[model samples]
Target: MNAKSSHPSHNLPSRRTLFTAWLVLMALTVGTMLAGHVTSTRSLGLLWTGGLLLISWAKARTILQVYLNLRAAPRGWQTGFNITLIMLLLLLLGLYAINALGLIPR
Candidate 1:
């Protein structure tokens, strides 16, 4: 049998794929910084905060799929991880919204 067929993690991503993923991640990082206004003292309102959260979710998914090689795992595993990440991000956004709305005291 060929080496690929014999390997358990046979569907590893190619170098080109890795490079592309890296580029996408870098671009998302820049997007996050811009959306969050990292270089400025300005506060990010609800919409910008949501955009930043979405960017972070994308970055996390990319790292999990590409860097951690979770893409080669079973579909159930992928779904589970995705759900977990989504829940976590939702929780963070909820907290941010509450604080921004002055529901919580400083």
Candidate 2:
């Protein structure tokens, strides 16, 4: 309704940007699969887990900043979302570590 609110900076992403993000996500997924398949030894499996964590973190960042339109938000909101994302990812990594260490049934 307001002129300031009708600015082009608030528009949704272009088709090309979304397509490029999708392609990057697909490639990261393939990389995750490859990381899994390449792991033969226990150490390699640990390495694969780290790789998966990084891949997932990147994916989450991409989703939050692009698909969720968090990048254009105010600094506090953006920081809050990023903090939540990091905490959740850390929890996931912790669960994976526990499972890998045989603390729980796989």
Candidate 3:
């Protein structure tokens, strides 16, 4: 490998980038709390639940890419991680749907 490629700073995110990512994660966290109605007794309907799930997916992606430094990984690795995350989220959503439909005993 080249000397430049071996440098630690090569794949590291800058402070500004990390700060921006932090800001985004915080915002998403607030959005999640709001969407999920953490402060209210009201239950979330399907639409709200879906929205919350989407926000959660976004937050997970941000954590994976920025905090975990997956952005610097190979394209195949990135894609694989993303696909796995998506599949897991989809499975959760599917189970929620099935429960919502009364397919399973409460």
TM-score, prediction 2: 0.71
Best by lDDT: 1
* Model 3 weakest 10-residue run by lDDT: 1-10
Best by TM-score: 1
Task: Please give the TM-score that candidate 3 achieves against the real structure.
Answer: 0.85
Pairwise TM-score winner, candidates 1 and 2: 1
**What does candidate 3's lDDT look like per residue over 1-106, in tens digits?**
7888875447888899899999999999999998999989986876788889999899999988888898988899889999998899889888788876678886
| Superposition error at 53 for model 1 (Å) | 0.9
> Model 1 lDDT vs. the true structure?
0.91
What tens-digit string does per-residue lDDT give for candidate 1 at 1-106?
A: 6877866487789999899999999999999989999889977988899999999999999999998889998899999999999999999999889978889766
* Deviation (Å) of 36 in candidate 2: 2.9
Question: lDDT at 39 for candidate 1?
Answer: 84
**Model 3: colliding residue pairs:** none
Question: What TM-score against the true fold does each predicted structure earn?
Answer: 0.87, 0.71, 0.85
Q: What is the C-alpha RMSD of each candidate to the true structure, in Å?
A: 2.5, 4.0, 2.5
- lDDT, candidate 2, 1-106, per-residue tens: 7886876458678788888889999998888777766555545445677787788888888888778777767788878988888898788878778877778855
Identify the runs in model 1 with alpha carbons over 4 angstroms from their true place.
Answer: 1-7
